[model samples]
Target: MLDSNETIVAIASPTTPAMRGIVRMSGQSVVPILEAVGIKSSQAKRAQVIQSRIDLGTPLGKLDIAVSLWPTSQSYTGQPSAELHTIGSAPVLQSIVNVLTTAGARAARPGEFTMRAFLAGRLDLPQAEAVLGVIEAEQRGSLEHALNQLAGNLSRPLEQMRSEMLDLLADVEAGLDFVDEDIEFISDEALVERLSVIHAAVDKTRQSMESRGGNRSRAIVAFRGNPNAGKSHLINALVGREVAIVADVAGTTRDVVSVETTLDGHAVQWVDTAGIESRAQHDPLFEITAASQAHALRASQNADVRIWCVDACHDDLAAQRRYFETHDGSSKRSSIDIWVATKSDLIDSTQRQPDWMYTSVITGDGVDRLRDRVSQFVASHDKEEVGSIMGTAARCSGSLAHAATCIETAIRFVQQGDGHEFVASELRVAVECLGEVTGAVYTDDILDRVFGRFCIGK
Candidate 1:
């Protein structure tokens, strides 16, 4: 862990030419820096715009700056903190940062200020991740989600669930420790019932989280089809630009080509995958193509939406069904599936499939409808997903997923009326996983994943 005892400083505000700029500091020695720089004030939270000499010992230059102090330890980082305010200038801010670093204060790393808050019990792991979400949010829906997380919307429920799980864990472990006593603090039936409730709650939370997150944060919409089906052209038409390779050859795209755009203020990531074939011949080139298709299929399975494209001029129901079976994730994911027959200009209107969207890149038929459909799908998902899915970070979701698996295993053991030790072990895994989400239980790796990319001075 980075040393929090030593003072750390960073320019809190943008270093652009503006009316004011801020050089913030957090540590035990924060107040002393202000004192050494001739800031004498006992009042906290008040911005004292008094002129003071910023001493660097060696002559870089002298400047007058305003200072504010949080002289107590109950500040943001649970340490004495201060912010030096001056006219907004990059060189001026850089000079102040240099001076602070020179005077026993080191530069704070990305997310260090927020990480310090997390370490000091000010914010939990989910909340810490939410800080980044707020920073990276591109739309209002995402911004609202981040602000909700910051207000403890997700953390509060997770905390309750963790507290209950901790109790159950204690009971299970205690029973194991005193196996000979035949004392049942929590009955097998009761344990089974409680575990079931938690399992459902966690499952509900995970699903809701996945949906809200997938929809709000750049939801991946993948286009899967046979070779020469005009998938690239379809994407280009939708995005109003040439982003992918369009060609007449089979196996043109041996990799997933993705582009990001916004629809109705919701960020959408559109992916055009390599054309997948059902029957495979034993050739090196075919194997490579198959491998690329497999990777794209996995991505498609997780994508928020899937656009399964087929040639409009061709008639092959079996091939279409096979493609749908492999690429469509309607049952497994909180997602939408759209079957599209591309190159519609060559086909008669009577030849169109009843429910399938038929589009032609050359004639521009159905392109606007397809784009509007996709946008409506996204907007609807954003509104409806909150009921069944919540969007937490990937790390937290993975932990929740694993915890759910462990809980399921424990419930089975309890129902089987055997293997108390095995049941206890499963409970431990579930609770520990749950605890990691809230930072009640964490490793250095978990900390790194959560806070590593945070901007300095956050």
Candidate 2:
């Protein structure tokens, strides 16, 4: 999938009119292509751009251009590579690409440049994926995180672990090889200790990916409650905009409405869902409303924090308890629950002041407090993840998790007095899993899935 034998050429800039654009060529024919464009020998490893117009083919007109050359192995692709800086025009770039192809260079494929780097051991699988993350960064935090990944902060530990695993596997395999002689090449005590070390490292990596690395996915904060509990109003209040429709009618919100915001540079999804009710709890098979409620419940379940709103004017404390009871705060990835007393302005001394945040949309009181609290919640939950050592990629995370599973099974095998061959086999599988995450091992299918998201010529 990563064929780097032939010289490849591509316009590396956006195909739009701009002040400048880059055209990249890599591999063996790069020198000839550079010379064909009138580059001097001293231009190697220099950023200086030589200005000139060269004859591109007979009828294709001369183009004023500048060339930056990296004539040795230190290039991005770890081979001879050059960049053509020219006026930004799609046709002009295509013409230049055509001229280069005529000079025995083929057009580069999507992500071929970075893929070449990965293939040539310039970047591992995680760092390669980080390139896409860097390109697709929606904010500063994500961009910095991508840069961290590109710097190999995540790959170093995984490589170390893989190295240790390799040594242990070798020792176990040696025992398996001499089983007929009853030779204990690696003792049960020593094997147990070694496996325990690898197991802890694998488990630590898994937990980091699950928690601190979790910000790689969207963080959802939801407003949920009984009908007309000011859920929509609260959402608008918190986001500082009227994204959700505000109304006095019961069951006004029959669907989930979302608005995105950033708190402390961390992205947040503020979700407003359909009001909770007994009918929703029933979730009748024939009802469409039940489906929307189910969706809301799922969203709430999956949210990082759920704001449960109860109106101060009404008394549904018993029903709210029942609602919280059935949901059973116990869940995998369970959301943090915040009880909120809404319509605080209408509350009189007779009304019971619930042990929760009091909010009043009419008076704009407590809205700022809510916003600040939400911001604090998001910041506290995700602040540590920004620019973390481990790069967040779902595919890589999954591989690590599966690798941990394999290691745990191997540990169990060792503890159960399993055969050296069986334990060794499990170790081999686990090593391969870790290798996939770091790109020390790869397949065409894996490469396709990893690089397919990259733009052409990246």
TM-score of each: 0.61, 0.62
Worst 10 residues of 2 by lDDT: 383-392
258-355, model 1: which lDDT tens digit per residue?
A: 98989879888989998876545866577787688787877787687788888887777457757577554443235667888888888788877787
Tens digits of per-residue lDDT for model 2, 433-453: 899989999899888888887
The CA lDDT at 73 in model 1 is 73
Top candidate by lDDT: 1
Stretches of candidate 2 off by over 4 Å are 43-51, 56-60, 177-185, 210-392
In candidate 2, list every pair of residues with a backbone clash.
Answer: none
